[model samples]
Target: MSEQADLKRTPLWDAHRRLGARMVPFGGWDMPVQYATGILAEAKAVRTTAGLFDVSHMGRLEVHGPTAREALESLTPNVIGKLALKKGHYTLFLNERGGVIDDLIVYCQEPNLYKLIVNASNTEKDCAWIQSHLPAGSVLTNRTPDTALLALQGPLAVTIMAAAGAPEASEIRRFERVAVRLFNNPAWAMRTGYTGEDGFEIQCSATSAENLWNALLRVAGPNLVPCGLGARDVLRIEAAYPLYGHEIDDDCNPWEAGLGWVLKKTEGFIGAEALARLKESQARQLVGLTMETRSVARQGATVLAGDRPCGEVVSGTFSPNVNASIALAYVDRDVTDETLTVESGGRRQNAARTPLPFVDLPVARKKKPAGLTSTASL
Candidate 1:
């Protein structure tokens, strides 16, 4: 690991290689894009059963002080004022113009302590931004190198967690965290995931991560397939979850990205003034689109309303679960029910405005033990 290679390798690098994973460079790290089972199969496995992901490549940081929440509020959009201890939330770091710098999950470890999980590529920039805006009493520490993240997702994810002796696992609600013992080691398990399924994101010490990973695989056996970024991308797209650089970026604000709901207008925070202005202007809107033909619309594709170009596609993919080509794009708000056209592969195809989550699953209705209410929320 060179100090200036613009790339970092996670602790599970060797383990992924041993598992015959196809290694690729992501955010300067050697990451597994997929395994021998391939992306389509892995996506199907997660939609049906469970899929395990090695997200150790992501970044983790700790903020400790009496004014931790206040300091964070100055940098992100989520209302940290009401966040209870041991709870976590999805938030975004905004620039002065209300543009998104990055999306992150903030964990309220204690009244005065917070843990921030961020995208791998934005670790340095995010840390610098947070540190620069911290109050006099606040302290920020980078813990990415010492922590490991593992996500177990799917309909049967809870079953695997319960079988692993995670008594509190069944009780953790969505977006909630609980300190539990897994494989006889201490771990912070959060009932949350990106696959839009019932699952948990377990954070543990780097030293014991491999042990827990192996134990999970053993417990899951054939049901839990080890998925990689390829499937993760597809699954998130299917669920209409936004991706950092694609769906949003430093050039796009929350309202333009279909994330205005995350902003609390009452709580004055950084970029609030600019966001209010953008809301008043409201020139564009984010929407989901389904192609009328079999052709797939990809990122950067041109979205046309009649003969005029209205907007551009952001994140898109051929939905394996829906068996159709779907895409998400930023279009003119005037484009309401009108049939539009998407230019892809040197051809234009008919597309229709549609609701998100092209494929909906009713897995949440399934019954589990009473103590598992916490996991259900995740």
Candidate 2:
């Protein structure tokens, strides 16, 4: 079999090929890494107007039963007790030692139904972990093979979505979702995305993905272009969004990843004791680094504090939005707020510890329209 045949393909594989995308293997799946326009162009398009991403490879799973919420709470850091119906929260699945298994987005789609969007590579592991910890009456279903995921991101995404038969797009607020009809098909439209922009993630059937994609293309026209994983990585890094296996992984805990806020000590959950201890001990910390030069520091690059090794770069990329070389790394808490040197491509570049989200979104906390209230129904 050809190398390409050995890799799994999403439903939009033909669409990406038709658009002349540069296909690559990502998380064991044949995915488009970029288009002919390049990552730089794709990033700019999303920041300025809108961009469409075929993220169908991401894992989608369902947890249902009377004890679903309790089961999920036992596995993730987010307080599931506080989640309202149809509301979503960003959470992390942690190991017994307080290390992150995967960062995920969980949505309480209904009173007893919960939906989880996990990293593509860790789908099986995440599902197994949840099932193993689930209560006796709870049930877990992996729907990744049947679901299609798409992200429409940018300042103008709402306009494009509204025009493409998603009139209720104007009613969904951030971290909220609604069951809506698109192109005469049912879809779960959520006001959330990886890019630090106003956007929506549309989930539907694999059979309906192509039709909706084409319809979105027709409506977005020149303003929205099809992007791929390469651009997604750069844009997410610019926004300071953590990536699984990069900014966080099985060996990294929430305290060291700058995600301590998500852990509510009062709420008894898995890894609570270990997390509390880590917070009190103050061992390591996650910090952002900006390079003095344009030479990018890549993952696994050695980070030096003066003459000694201090840490390793986890996620590093050439940020198209900031026009700088940026990275996220873990360093000793005491070593934070200090200057360091990074070895990239056999050259040493000066770097300094900076705050998370090197590039801030101007209106991250802006209020949505009145019609976008949480209680609004489609």
Candidate 3:
């Protein structure tokens, strides 16, 4: 219970409490980690049907003006110049040493306007970093406090959104966004999600959150249930999405985390040179592991080969959908693509290094038209 005076609360705080959520402190906010249905149930719901999450805790920053695009391109490694309007992609904020500051989604809304959705815990730090690097004619605004974000995820999410009166939802492709009016209030519907499911992340004003939430629930009725952080964590881990502190941090670079695809060396961004060097000398590689036994390997659990430690678990869970214990771990570069072991519940269990994304994503990547450049999908 984060009852501290300084702890922040989202606009949906009251609704969560009313629905019997188990509140806990997350990123300095009193957030719901699970509701009466519990983490596993919520995780299953999202995997099978649909689940709604109050992700208002995330930070939303708007940047626009003459040099906004150039300034943003200079801050991150991704090629912002190629990001078409209404398109968004996952990228990272990194330090000069190629260390991750945070991973975020950047959306190019218009010619000179963009929106950055960043992690809640590092919102202030990210804002300050942006301020320090602001280009002469660009403007930055923190829109977190006045916004409410909801993730409607799963196979049936499209149906739910359609029922909620957003028929344009089906027209939005993955990584694309559209400005729309929902429940008579202005909103942005983006075909993106943290969970591995096909979904839409809806952003609306804080003042309208309650009504919107209620309307969504009424429309989505038995198909969509409220989920919380616990389920969110399990879903993300199952999807092989790295959490900031768990799989990456200030001391880690993108290459070590298996996210090298997003790094563009030619862009010459802040950490480009350092990342290029580290890519040559990369020592560790993040990989997915499936345990042979039923025991769950937890974060920080030492991965062993015979008697020697080779790596450690960064994220782990008993996946209900997979019907097995799965985890993400970092091992020495030479130790990757091999079977290993981890001590769980005082027993050593055999673990096999598996390809990332323990589960297939609900929406497959749209194949580029033959001979066309790949900018649209990135």
Candidate 3 lDDT (Cα, 0 to 1) = 0.89
lDDT (Cα atoms) of all candidates against the true structure: 0.86, 0.86, 0.89
Question: Where does model 2 exceed 4 Å of error?
Answer: 1-3, 265-267, 336-338, 366-378
Tens-place lDDT digits, model 2, residues 1-378 = 487788888889998999999999888799999999999999889999999999998999999999998888888877897988899998988887888999999999888899999999999899889988999888999998897999999988988987888876976878898888887789989999998888999998998888888888887899898999999999888888889889888878877787887785444677877786776775777778999998888899988888788888988888888888899887777785468999867889899787778777733666678677655542
Which of the numbered candidates is closest to the native, going by highest lDDT? 3
Which lDDT value does model 2 have at 36? Answer: 91
Q: Local error of candidate 3 at 225, Å?
A: 1.1
Candidate 1: 10-residue stretch with minimal lDDT: 357-366
> Compared to the true structure, candidate 2 yields what TM-score?
0.94
TM-score between candidate 1 and the true structure = 0.92
Off by over 4 Å in 3: 1-3, 344-346, 365-378
- Displacement of residue 122 (Cα, Å) in model 1 is 1.1
lDDT of 3 by residue, 259-378 (tens): 888886444678877876787898888989999976889999999876788889999998877888999998888874478989856779899888879888766556568568566334
Q: Point out the higher-scoring one by lDDT: 1 or 3.
A: 3
